[model samples]
Target: MDATTMADAILAALGGAGNVRGVTHCATRVRVDPAESARVDVTALARIPGVLAAQVVGDRVQIVVGPGRVEAVSGAVRRGAGSATAPAHRGRLSARTVGVLVDVFTPLLPAFVAGGLLTALHNVLAGPGVFGDTAVIDTLTWLRGPVALVGLVGAAVFALLPVLLGFSAAGRFGGSPYLGAAMGAALVAAPGLTADSALPAIHLTPETGWVIAGVDVLAIDYQGTVVPIIAICFVLARLERFFARRTSGSARLLLVPLLTLLTTGLLAFLVLGPALRFLGDAAAQGMEWLYTGAGVLGGALVGAVYSPLVVTGLHQGLIAIELGLLSTGGSFIFPIAAAANVAQAAASLAVWLCARRGTRLRALAATATAPAALGIAEPAMFGVTLRLRVPFLIAVGATAVSAALLAAWRVEAVTLGAAGLLGFASIAPGSVGPFLACLAVSMLLSFGGTLAWARWRRRRGRPIDGEDPRRSGDETAILSPVAGRRVAVESLADQAFAASALGPTAAVAPESGLITAPVAGTVSAVAATAHAYGITTDGGTEVLVHIGIDTVRLNGDGFRPLVRAGDRVAAGDPLARADLDAIVAAELDPVVLTIVTEAGARTFAPIDGETRVVAGTPVLGPVGSPENI
Candidate 1:
C-alpha cells in the first residue's frame, strides 16, 4: 500500500488521528503512544497490508512494517496525527525517556550509516597492514589525497556529533534548532577556556581553571559526547521558552535567543556540561568494563536479549551507548547484534526449508530470510520465527553461542553498518576474521538447530509449519450474513482479506442494510463502532462478519448492534444494521465480508461463481460438501 493509505488505515485502526498521543519509528516498527490504548484495534492493524505484525508493548502500539518502508509510513503517520511536537510522556518514565531518546537520534541514522561505511573504506585503503605489510594508500602514493579526503569526510559526523545532537534535541524539546546547534558548536570549539589558549596569561586546567564557589571548573572537550549535549539542549529548550514567555513582539525575538543562549551556555560550561560529561563517560566505561571484565558471559547475555530488546523497542536506547563506545575505541555491541541478526535469518531459512511447498508459512519465511540476512530482521523475527514460537528460541540460543565466541576472540566493530553478513566491512580490520567466524557459527547453529527441531516434530507426527495446532473439530458450513451479490475474496480491493491473512473469506455487496448471525452460537464479540461482529459456531468455527470497509471510522454513526457478546443467536438472526448509503457517502466500500477467521480442522471452500444471494444461505463449506440451499 502507498504510505498515505497505509498511514490512514493505521490511524483508523488506532482509533483515528485524534487518539494518537505521540508517534515515532525505529528501523522497522512505527511506535505509537495512543491517547486511549483500549481503543486500538489490533486485529484491524494486523489486517493492514505491508504490516508484518502489530503488538502492544507497555502503552505503545508497535506496528512492524519492515525496514525500507517504516520511515515513509512513520512520516505519514506523524503528519496525519500532528505529533511533530515532543512526544507526550504517557507510559512508564523509562519508556517515555527512551521514546524521547529515539526521537533525537533516529533522524541521524543516515549520517551515521554513511559515515560508518566511509570510515570502513578509509580503514581498508589507508590503515596499516589492511593489505599485506602496507596499506593501499601507501602502495599507491597518487591515491593519498583522495584517501585523506575520504577519512576526513568519514570522521566528520562523529567529530561534530554533539552539534547534531544539539540541533535534534532542541527541536525535540520544542526550541530553536539553530541556537541549540550554536551551543553544541561552543562545546567543540577550540582555544576557548583551554589550557593553551590564544590569549596570553589566560590558561585553564583542572588545577588552575576558574573556581566556581570553591569548585574548580575543568575545561573539557565535548566533541563526541552524547549525554552532555542532550541534557544541555533540554535545558536550552526550557530557557528559550522561559525567555520567550516573558518578552513580547520584537523584544521577544531579540531577548529570547540572546538571553537563552548566554544563560544556558554558562550553565553548560560551569555545571551541566562538566557533570553530564562525567555521567556519559561513566556509562561508556561501565559498558567497556562489562564486556572486557565479564568476557564471554557478557557478550552472550547481550546477544541473547538483543532481539527481545528490539521487540520491546528498548534497543534504540542502545545507540547512545554504542556511540559512546565508538568514541572511546570500538563497540562490542555491534558485533553481537550482527551475530544475533544472522542467527535469526538462518532460523527463518531453516523454517522455509522445512515448510511444505506452496504453503503460506513457506512463502512468508522465503520472503523474510533475505531481508534478515541484510540486517533488517523484523520480517523474519516478527513475521516468521516469532509466529512459529520454536524458531525464535533456537535463533536466540544460537546467537548467544556465537556472541560468546566473538567475545572470546575480542572481536569488535569500529562503526555501524548492516548487522548481518555485510557487517564484516564495519569490523576493525584485525578483528574481521573473528567476526566472520562467529557469524558463520551463528548461521550454521541456528539453521541446524531449527531444522533438527522440525525433524523432531515430524517424527512425533506433529505438523512442522503448515499445520495450526489450534485446528480441531469437524468441518461445517458458514451462512452468509447479508443478502447481496456474491464477490470473490481474491477480487476484493482490501489486500489483507484478499490474501487470506485472516483466514478464508468471501465478500458480498449488500442488497440490504440488515446484518445477521452467520453461525448458530454465542456472539463472541461486538465492535463498539457496530461495524463488525464475531460469532463462534457450535462446532467451534470462529467467524467475523464485517459490515463495510473502513467503517470503523463511522464511530457507530449509521450502525447499530442488535446483539451483544454472550448472546446466543441462531443463523439468520439479526446481528446489526448498517447504513449502506452512509458508508458510500463517507467514501468507503460498502461490501460485507463473511470471514472464517479460524476454521479448526476444516478447509473453507467459498462458493464458486458471483451470484446474488440472500442472508442465511450457505456461502462456505468443506470441500465437495453439498450447499444447504
Candidate 2:
C-alpha cells in the first residue's frame, strides 16, 4: 500500500493534525500522541488499507504497520501534519498526564530496551541458564571478557539516562535541550559523586532503613535514577526560562545556562533529589507489600487494572517496579499481564468469528488478532473489544479470574518477555504448568463468555430497525420452517426479523439440524453460508428463512445444502443440513427467523415454550383471521 495515502488516512482517523500533540514512529508502529486520545477513530484506522492494527495506547493513537514501512508512514504523517498543533481542548486530566508521559519517555525507550536486553542476555548466556540458576558463570574466565563487554555496552546507555532525559524534558518544556543535557551531565560529572552511592546520613531507620526524616535524601548517587532526574529537569526548565526572559543577546544565552544551572543544580541536589527518591522508594515498596500480602486478591486487582494502565500508557511507569521486583527475586506482574493480554486477544478472536464473511471488520480483526498472540494486544483491545464496550469488560473479568488462579499457584516470572503466549518462557520453570493452565482457562472463558453474552444480548430483542412495529388492521400468515419450538417474532433476537418489517415472522429453535421448506415455492436465494434461504410461495408471498444470527460468518462451514436457488420445492422438502453443534461451538445464536416479505401477517405462538413444532406449522394465521391478532 502507498505509505502516503495510508499516512493521510492515519492522520484523518486521528481527528486531523490539529488534534495531534506529537507524531513519532517506533520500529513497528506509528505513534500519534493526541490532545484527546479518545477522539481518535481506532476502528476506522484498523479498516484503513495497509494498517495492521490501530489503538489508543495512553494519550497516543498507535497504528501498527510493519517495520520498514512505519518510517515511511511516519515521515508522510509529519509532512502531512505540517504546522498544525494540538488544540487546547479540556480533556480528562489523567489522560493528558499520560499523554505527556508518553511524549517524554517514548523517544528514550530504545535505549532502555537495549540496556534491559543486554542485562537479560548476559544473565542468560554467562551467569546462568536463561530460566535457571547459574553461579558457575562467575568462575568462567573466558566468558568474563565477552559478558563484561556486553554488560558495558548495555550499562553505557542507561548510565547517562539523566542527560538524555534532561534534553528531552527541556525541549518538551520549551527550554534549550543542549543546556538541559549539560546540567544533567553535571549531576554525574560532579567530583566525588558516584552512581548509587550512599550519602552521609545523620541517622538511619531500623524499619525502612533510610528515612529522609533523619538522613539526607540526596546522599545516594543519581546514576540510572528516573524520578529524581525528572524532578531536576522540571525545576531546571523553569529556571532556564526565567533567566532567558530577564537577560539579553549573547549575554542572555551565557547567563541563562550559567545561572539556571547553578540555581537548579543546587535545588536538585538539596531538595528535588531527596524528596523524589523518598517518594519513589515508598511507592516501589508499597507495590511489593501489596503483591506479597494480598496474593491472589492482589493479582486479581492488578490484572483488572493493568490493561487500563496499558490503555492510558501509565504502564510504562511500572518499569521501575518491575525491575525492582525482578532484581530482588521474581516479578508477579508478568503472569497477571499474560492473563489480561491473552483474554483480550481471545475476546478479539470471538469477535472475528462472529463477524460476517468478507466484511471490512472481519478483515481488520484478522490483522488485529494476529499480533495479540505474541503479547501485542493494543490492536485487539482498542480496535475490537474496547470499541464494542461489552467484550472488553468480559475480557477484564476473565483476566481477573485467570490472574487469581495464577496467584493461587504462586506463579512468578523470572524475566520479562512478550506477555501473551510467548510469555511462558519468562515464567519460573517450576510455575510453567500453572501459567499454561491459567492462559488456557482465561482464553476459553474470554472467548466462550463473549460469544454467549453477545448472543444473549442480540436475542434480548432490541428495537425494531427501519419499519414500524404496529400491524395493519388486516393480517396474513407465514409458515414455520424446520423447528423444534416455535416462538413469536417479537421474541426473536434480530430486530429486523422480530419487528416483522417485511411482514409477520416466526422464530424456530431447531431440534434436528434439518432445514426444510416451509411452503411450496420456488427457491429464490440461498446464502453462501447456506444458513439463510429465501423462497417465493405459489400465492406470490415472499418468505425468508434465515437460520442463526451471525452464523453467515461461518462461510458455509458445517452447512450442507440439499437444493439451490431456482429449484422448485414443496412444503417439508429438505433444504439444508446444519451442524448445530458447530454453530454453538462457533458461538452463534441458533434461533431461525421465518418471515413474510410482502403480505401482512401476525404471529401465533405455541402454548408451551418448548413444544414440538415443524415445517409448514401455521405460526401466522391467514390475513383477517381472529388468531392473527
Candidate 3:
C-alpha cells in the first residue's frame, strides 16, 4: 500500500486513525499511540495483508508487519499522525493482545535461533574448504548453500529485532512505539557493544566480568533474546514520564531526551544485561521441564490459561521460555504451546459453524478462526471461544489430547512460524507425521466436543454456562427491547444484575398488557397529559420519555400503572401498559422512543434498534440536560 493508504490501514487496524496520536515503525512492526490504549483492534491488525499480528506492550501499540515492511509501515504511521504531541490519555497493554503477540511473534523466534545455528554451521562447514576441491569431504560441504540460506533467513528475524519487540513493548507501556524500536536499535549499534557479544552487558565497573572486546558486552547485540531490551525500554519510558512531569522550560524537552538516554543506558549496564541471562535461563529451563514432563498435558494447561494470561498482562513472561529453549536446542513448552493454540482455533471454529448466531457474531467467529488456526489464539480465545463455557472446554480438551499425542510420538519441531499447519513445516521430517496426528486429534476432538455440547444445551432449552460462570457474568441478562408484553418477572431472559447504571435495573410491572418505565431519573416533567414520565440517570442529566411521542394526545386514556412516584425500577420492570393497536391506529409508531434528551451524554449511543431490549434497562444516558424535561 502507498504511504497514506498504509498509514490509514494501520491506524484503522489499531481501532482508528483518530485514536492514533503518533506512529513509527521498524523492520517488522509499527508503533502507535492510540487515544485510548484499550481501543487497539488486535484482529483487524492481524487480518491486514502485510501485517502479521498486533501487540500492546506497556504504553505503545505495536503492529507486526515483518522486517522488510517495517520502514514503509513506520513511514506511513509518522506521516499519518503528523506532529501531534502525546495526549494525556493513557492505557495499559491488554493481556489478550499480549498473548497474540507472544504466540505469533515467538513462533518466528526459531528463525533467530536458526540463523545463529546456521551461522555456526557455516563456520563448521567452511572450515575445511572442501567445496573448492570437490573432494570426497567436499561432497558433504555441498550442502553449505542450503545451510547458509537457512541460517541467514533465521538471522534475518533478529536483524529486524528493533521493530519486533520495540513495537510490542511500546504497546505495553503506552508510549511512542516507534521510538521504543529505535531505542532498541541503538543498543545493538556498533558503538554499543564489541564484535562477539550476544546481548548488551551491564557492569558496575570496568573491573567487572571482563568484556568480549574493548567495549562492554552490555553494549553488544541485545537482539533475538528477550528481557534485557524490554527492561531497558521500560525504565526509559518511566524516566521519560518523570521528566515530562517535572520539567517545564524549553530546555525541559532537551532534558527529557538526555535524561532518558543516560538513565536507560546506565540501567542497561547495571541491570538489564545481567538480569536477562538469569531470566532467559530460568524461562528456558522451566519450559523445558514443562514440555518434557507434561508434554501434551502441559500444552493443554497452557492453552486453557493462555487467554486469561493475556488479560492479566503476564504473557510476556512466557517469552523467556522460547528464548531459553531455542538457545538450549529445544523446548517442550514452545512446541506444545503451539499445539494448544491450534486446538483453541479448532474449538472456536466449531462453535462458529455449529451455532446459529447472527451475522455480527458469525463474522466475529470467522475473523478469529484463521489466526487461531495459525497458532495465534488470542483473538479466538478472547473474541470467540472464551465468551462461553463449552468452547473453552473444547479448546482445552483438544489441546491436552493433541499435546499428549505429540509427547507420546516424540514429535520435534526444528523451526517456528506459529502453531498451525504452516507451523508444522518447522517440525523435523522424522517427527512431522506424529505432530500432524497430534494436531488432527486436537482439532477433531475439541471441535466435535464443543459442537455436541452446544447442541445438547440448545435441545434442552437451557444455557450452557461455558468454561467459567464468573468470566461470562450475566451475558444473557441484557434488557429486551419489546415494547409491550407482560412476561414472567424472572425468566431465562433476565440474567444476573450488577451494581452499575449499565448493570441491572429491577422493578415490578404496574399494568399487565405491556410494561415500560421511565428508566432514568433525570426526567422531571412528563407530557402535559401525564401519559409518560421524565427520567434522569446521568448523574445530573435528564431525559423525556413521551410514550409514543404524539401519543401525549391520548392524555393517559388507555394506560395503567404499577409502582408510582419515588419508586426505583430496573430494566425489564413493568412500569405502565400501553394499547399498541390504538397507538398504531392513531398513526404513531409503536416503537419505544429513546430520545437523547441529555445534552452532555455523548458517550451513550443507541445499540442498533435490532437488539432485544427490556423495560427499565438503561440504554442511553447522561441525564439532566437543559434541553431535556
Candidate 4:
C-alpha cells in the first residue's frame, strides 16, 4: 500500500484516529501513544504492507516502516490523528523527554550531513599528504579560493547551530520558532554578549565576569552550544504561553511576542544560558572522561547496549549529548555506533547467504542487508538477526570487540553522518584509517561467527532458521472445532486471524452453533464475554478458540460457555454454543477461528485444499504426520 493508505490502515489498527493521543517518528519507526493501549491491534498492524514489525514498547506503540518511508507515513498519520500533544498522565517522564529531543534534532540531519561531508572534502584538498606534505590546494594554486570557500561553508552549520536548534526546540515546546531563532541569534550574534566584544560600561576578562544580582553571568561564547539554547527555548515556550493567556485582542499579538522575547532574553543571558552552558560543558567533559579514562571498556559497554537502547527507543536522548560533545571538537559515540551498525549488517548478510533460496527468511535477509550497510540497522536487526536470536547475539559480541578496537585507536567523528561503511568521511581525518580498520573487524567477526553457526546447524541436520529439529513422530493432530466449510486463514476478513500473528491458525464458516474442543487439554482461560476460550493441550500447544468476529461486544447476549478456567476437556467435547441467528442479525461474522497461540517445541501445519470438514476431524497437525497429509 502507499503511504496514505498505510497511514489510514495504521490509524484503524490503532483503534481509529480517535484513540490516538499523539504521534511521532524517528529514523525507522512511527511511534503512537494511544488513548487506550488495550485497544491497539498489534496483529493487524504487523499485517500492514511495508510494516517490518509492530511492537509495544512501554506505553507507546512503535510501527517500524523503515527509514526513508517513515517521514511520509508519519506525516500522514499525524494529520489523520490531529493534534500531537500527548496526555500528561499517559507516559513516563523519561520517554517524553526523549521524544522531545528526537523531535528537535531529527529534522537537522540533512544540514549536518552536508556540512560534515564538505568538511571532509576540505580536509582532503587543503590539509597535508596529497603530495608528500604539500596540500592539493597548495600545489594547484587556482583551487585555493574554492577550497577555502568549501571550508567556510562547511563550518557555517556548526558555527550557527544554536539558531537552528533554538527554532526546532521552540516548535517542539509549542512556542514560536522564529522568536526562538531570535533568542539564539542574540546569544551568538548580538554585540556585548560575545567574547569578541564587551559592554563599554563594564571592564571584565574574556573568560570571567562578576556576579550580577547574585548570579554569575559568565562571558563565554554560545556559538555552537546545545543545552543552553534548548533550555532557553523551554522557558521561552512557557513564557509565550503565559503572556498569550493574559493578554487579549490587539495587545495579545503585540504584547505576547514582545514581552515573551524581552523577558526570556533577559533570563537567558543572566540565568539559564550561563547555568545550562556549565551543565552542557560538564556533560561533554563526562563523556570525554568516559572515552579517555575508562577507554576501551567503556566503548565496549556502549557498543554492547547500543542496539538494545535503540530497541527500547532510549537512543533518542543520546543525540543531544552527541551534539554537545561535537562542540568540544569530536564525539566518540559515532565511531561506536558505526561499529554496531556494520556488525548488524554483516550478521544479516550471513543469514542471507545461509538461508535457502525462495524462502521468506532469505528474501527478508536480502532486503535488509543493503540498508543496514548504509547505516540504517532497524531492518536487519528486526527482520533477520533478532528474529533468529543467535545472529543478533553474534552481532552484539562483534560490535563490542570492534568498538573497543576503535577506542584503543582513539577514533572519533568530527560531525554527524551515516554510521556505517560510508561513515569514514565523518571521522576525524587522522582517525579515518582506524575507523575503517575497526569497521572491518566488526564485519569479519559478525559475518564469520554467524556463518559458522549456520554451518554447524547444517552439519547437525538442523534448521538454519533457528526452529526445532524434532522428528515428526512427536506430532499432535488438532481437530476441527466446529462443523463447517474449511477456509484458509489468509482468506479470513479479520486481519489479526489472517496474519496468523497469534500463531498457526485455521478458520471454519460454522454451519452449527456448537463449538467443540479441538484437542484433549486443560482450559487455560475463558473470556469474561464468553466469546473465546484458551486451552493448553497435553503436548503443550496453546489453542485459542474465538467464537465469532467481534462477538465480545455482544456481552454474552447470544453466547453460552460450557467450559471454565482449570476445567479439563476431551477432544470433540462441546466447549460453547453460539446463537448463529443472533450473530447474523447483529451483523458480525460467525466464522469460528482456532489458533495455535503457542506451538512450543511442536510445529503446526494446517491441512489444505479441504472444502469442508466435519467437527472433530483433523484441521491442523505437524508436518509429515498422517493428519497433515
Candidate 5:
C-alpha cells in the first residue's frame, strides 16, 4: 500500500494524530511513543495486512515490517503525525546504502561471533601444557587451523567493512562502486611489507625512510586494519569526477587517485595513524580514571549506555574502552560489557516468559535472545527489545547490576572482540571466577525483573470479556459481522476503494460474510462506484464499509445493495450482497469490513485464531474510548 493510505489508517486506528507522542525507526521497525500505550489496539495492529508484528517497548510501541519498509513506514509515520509537522529526515546514507549496512552486519554476525569464540578457545587450548600431549596436540591441530582460517577471514571482512561501506556509499553518491572499492584496495596494497610482517615494509625501512614533502612518512600495512584510507577513497572518487571535466582519461584517473593515495596514505602513516593511536591510548587512560576514581558508578553508567551506543553504530568506537580495561588491570569495563551483552538475552527470556499466549511475541523474543547471548545485540536491541517494554528495562537493570559486581570484583580482561560469556577468557585468570559470578547475577536479575513486571501488568490490566469500562451510557457497540480474530480497522488504500472499509483501513476476514453493520448508524458517504459506504452509527461513530478495490468500476452491477447514505441500519442488517463470481471476474479480492470512522472509542481484539463470528458480536470497540478519539 502507498504510504499515505497506511498513514491514514494508522492515524484513524490511533484515534487521531494527537494521541501519538512521537515516532521513529531504526533500520527495520517503526517505533511509536504513544500518549497512552493502553489505548493501542494490539489485535487491530496485528490484523493490518501490511504489518508483521506490533509491540510496546518502554514508552514506545513498535510496528515490525520487513526490510525496505522503513521509507514507507517513515512516510506513513510522518503523515500520521500530521501533514503540517514534517520532521527532519536523517541517516548519512540512503535506503540502498543503509540496506548494505544491514546486509553486511546481519549475515556476518554469526561468523564474527564464531571466529571470536574459536580464537579465544584456541588461546585456551595452546596455553601452558593443556595441549602438550601428542594426541591432544594432534587432534586440536586441525581445529586451530580452521579456527585461524575462519578468524582471519572474518577479521579481514570486519577490518575492510569501511571499504565496503565506501563502495556502497559511492554508488549512492552517483559514482562507480567497483572502481571506488578498487581504489581503496590499491592504497592498502601499496608497497606493503611481506605477508607475515605486522607492519608494511616500504622501499625504505625506518633507517632509510624517505621524506614526503618535509616529514618522513613510514609505510604501514593496511590489511586487516581500520584506518582513514576508506574515507580518502571516497574523496578521491569525487576528485576524479571533478578533474575529469578538465583533464582527460588516464591522467584524470592517475593524478586524482594517485594524489589522493599519496596525500592520504602519507598523512595516515605520518600523522592520522599516530594521532588515532594516541587518541586510543588517551581514551584508554580516561576509562582507567573512571574505573579507579568513581569505581562502580562508572561501570554502571557504561553498561546502561552501551545498548544505545550500539544503536547509533558508534559502539565500535568503544574498542578503546575494552582495550583500556584490558591494558589496565584496574578496570572492569570489558567483563561488565560482556555481562551486559548476555544480560540482553536474559531480558529477552523474561519477555518471552511473560508474553500472552499465542501472540508469536514469544517466538520473536526467543530468536532475538540467542544472538544477544552471543554478544550481538543488534538482533535483540533492534528486533525485540526495541519492540517490547519489559525486555528493554530488564536488560538495562541487568546491565547496571552486573557492571556493579564486575567493578567490585576488579575484573580485568586481555583480549579483543565481542565474545559474550566466553569473553571470560579475556579476563585475568585470577578474576575469572568473580566475573562469571557477576554475569550470572546480571542474567538472573534481568530475567526475574522483566518477568515480575510483565506479569503484574498483564494481571492488573485484564480487559472485560464483554465490555469496556471506559464506555458506559450512550456508548455505541461496533460489533463484528463474522466471529473471527479481530483484524485492524484502519484507513483505505487510495488505490483501493476499501480504504474506508475497516474505518480508514480495510478489515481482514476472519470468515466469509455479506458485510453488515456492527453498529446501527447513519450513512455518511457512499462511493459513486457503489462498492462502499460511510456511516455514522447512532452513538455518533462514523464508519466506512467498502466492498473491494476498484469494485466501484463494477458500479453495483455485481453488488446487490440493501442500504444507501442517510439510511439507519441496525446491527446485523445486511448492507450489500457481493456477487462472488463477478468479484472474481473483476479481478478483486472479496474481503469486506465494517469500520469506525469517528475518533475516540474503546477497541478490543479477537481472543486468538480466527473464531466463528456472527453479525452483532463484539468485534472492535465498545465506543467512547481512544479507538474512537
Candidate 6:
C-alpha cells in the first residue's frame, strides 16, 4: 500500500486520529499514545496489508510496519492524526510530565539500551577473579586494550547521554536543539563542587563559583541520567524561545544563550537539579523497598505491569532503576520480563492452534508468534493476544505465577537482553536452570489456558476472535486476497487492469506482503514472474490476481510464492508473501488487480470504493449476480 493508504488504515485502526495523544516511530514500529486504548482494534490492525503487527504498551499503540518504512508511515500518520484530532486533554500534571518524558526518551532507546548492555558486558569481563588467582597480567593480557576500547565506546554513549537527551528535549519542546546541546555540554564541564569549610566533615573544599539566585553552584555530572537533563533542557529551550521572540538576529543569538544559561543554571542548581535527583533516588528507594519487602508479590506485580509499561514508554524510565539495581546487586526485573514475553508468545501460538485450518487468521497468527519467542513480542502481543483481550489476560495471569516463582528462586540476569530464547544466556551464572523451569511452566500454563478458553467460546457458540465465517459448499465468493484499501481498477494511473482487453477487474492497495487465496478452488496457474496467480473457483469462475504494476520486471526479487499450480486450497489460504517495500523501492505501484479471467464474465458483484478490509472479506463474485445464491 501507499504510505497514505497505510496511514489512513492505521489511524482508523487506532480509533481514528482523535484517540491519539501523541505519535512517534522508531525503526520498525509506529508508536502511538492513544487517548482511549479500549477503542483500538488490534485484530483489524494485524490484518492491515502492510502492518506486521500491533501492540499496546500502557496506553500506547505500536503498529509494526517493518523496517525502513516507518519514517514515511509515521510522517503520514502524524499528518492525518494532526488534522483529524483535537488538542490533547491532559488531565493531571503527572500525566503531562509522563507524556513529555515518553516523547523525550522514546527516540533514544537504541543508544541507551546499547550503553546499558555494554556496561553489563564490562562488569562481566573485568569484575573480580577473571584470571582466577593469577595476579599480574596473566593469560589474556593481549586482549586488554581491545576489550577496554569496547567498554570505552559504550561508555562514550552513556557519558554523553545528557547531550542527546537535551537535544531531543529541546526539539520536542520547540527550541533550537543545538543550544540545548551547548547547555548540556556546559553541565558536563562544570562537574559540581563540594563545600569543605561550611560542611567540614567530608574533606571537600568550597570554591569560587557563579551563584545563581541564593543557591551556591555545584555542577554535578549528568551522565546516564535523563530526567534531570531533560528538565534542564526543557527550561533552557523555553528560555531560548522566550528570548528569540523578543530579540533580533546577532544579539538574539548571543543574549539568548547567555540569559538561558544563567536562568536555567540557577533553576537547575536551586530547584530542578535537587528535585530530579530526589525523584530518582526516591524511585530507586521505592523499587528497592518493593523488591526487598514485597518479594514474590512484588515480582508478580512487576511481571503483570511490565509489558504495559513498555508500551506506554514508561519502561524507559525504569531503565534508571535497572541501572541502580545493577549498581547495588543483580537485576531481578529481567527474569519476570522474560516470563511475561514468553507466556504471551505461548498464548498467541495457542490462538493459532484454535483458528480454523487453511485460513488467513491461522497464517498471520503463525507468522506473528515466532518473533515473540525470539523477544520481539510486539507483533504477537498486539497482533494476537492483547488484540483478543482474553489471551492477553491469560498470558498475564501465567506471568504472575512464573514471576512469583522466579522471585522465590532468586533468578536474576546480570545483563539486559530480556527476550525469551536469548534471555536464557543472560541469567546470573547459576540461575539458568530455575529460569528455564519457570519459563517452561509459564508457557505451558498460558498455552493450555488459552486453548481451554477458545474451546469454551466455541462450545458456547460465542464469536471466536480467530474463527472463519461459515460458508456454503457451493458458495461462489471472491474474498479479498490481501488486506488493504480498495481502489477501482478504473482509477489506475496506467489503466492496464481496466482496459477493454481485460474483463471485470478491481485493484487493491495492499498494506501487507502476504497474498491470500481469494477463492476456494484449484490453483489454475502460478505466473512465472510470481506476481500473479490464476485460480478457478469451485463455482467454475477463473480469477486472475495480479500483484502490481511492472512487478514482473523485478523477477521475483522479494516475492515468495507459498503454493503451486493445481493445488487444491480453501479461501484464505496463503498464496504468497510479497515484499511491498521492495516493490515501492523499485518504483512500482503495489496495486493488486483481481480480474475475472473467464471468457464472458460481463460484470462483478457491486463493491464500493474507499473500503478497507482484511484478507478474507468478500470483495467480488456472485453477490451481485442474478443467480447470487
User: lDDT of all the models against the reference?
Assistant: 0.75, 0.66, 0.52, 0.75, 0.55, 0.68
Can you give the TM-score per candidate against the true fold? 0.44, 0.41, 0.43, 0.44, 0.45, 0.42
Better of 1 and 5 by lDDT: 1
User: What's the number of clashes in each of the models?
Assistant: 0, 4, 62, 0, 30, 13
Candidates, ranked, lDDT: 4, 1, 6, 2, 5, 3
**lDDT tens string, model 2, 1-629?**
79889878888888897777777654345667787776788889889987766766446676766433666787678767762332232334553444444445546655544564565455455544334544335666677788879878866665676787778877766677887788778665543332224643433332333333554433445665555666677677878766876788999967988898888877776677766666555644554576678988876876777776655434545677888789988988888888888898888888787664654445545655655655656556655676555687888999888988988898998988767776777889789889999999889999998888756644543110101122212223455677677666677654434555445567788887888766666677665456767777655666677778656457667787766555555566677888999999997878877765545243333222236676656665554554444
Could you give candidate 3's per-residue lDDT for residues 239-325 as a string of tens digits?
A: 776676668788786787777777766666556655665554554455456666675565555545544443332444566566665
Q: Which stretches of candidate 6 lie over 4 Å from their true place?
A: 1-139, 187-189, 192-221, 302-402, 410-432, 435-629
Error of 3 at 277 (Å): 5.6
Candidate 4 local lDDT, 1-629, one digit each (tens): 88989999999999999999988664345779899999999999989998877888668888877543766798789877875542122223553454455457656655654565565566667765433457788889999999999988866876787798889989988899999999988877753443454565554455566576776655456765666788899999999987876788999988999999999988998888767665555544555566677888987877787776544333544677889878898988888888888899899899999876755567768867765675666557656776566798999999989988988887888887767777776788888888999999999999999999989977754445432223121336778899999877888765446677566788999999999878766677665556778877656777878888767557677887765555556666678889999999998989998877667776888877568889877788877777666
Q: Comparing 2 and 6 by lDDT, which wins?
A: 6
Q: In model 4, which runs have C-alpha deviations exceeding 4 angstroms? A: 1-89, 92-95, 130-132, 190-218, 288-295, 299-400, 406-436, 442-629
Tell me, by TM-score, which candidate is best.
5
Give candidate 2 misplaced runs (Cα > 4 Å).
1-89, 109-120, 131-144, 186-215, 218-227, 292-295, 304-402, 412-430, 439-629
lDDT of 1 by residue, 542-611 (tens): 7888877656556667886766555546666678888889999998888998877667777787876449
- Evaluation by lDDT, superior candidate among 2 and 4: 4
Sequence-dependent TM-score of model 5: 0.45
Relative to the true structure, candidate 6 reaches a TM of: 0.42
Task: Count steric clashes of candidate 2.
Answer: 4
Per-residue alpha-carbon lDDT of candidate 5 for residues 378-495, written as tens digits (9 for 90 to 100): 5565445644434676788788878877877677776654547656656676887888888898888888887777677556542111112333224444566544444443443422
Residue 110 error for model 6, in Å?
5.5
Which residue pairs collide in model 1, if any? none
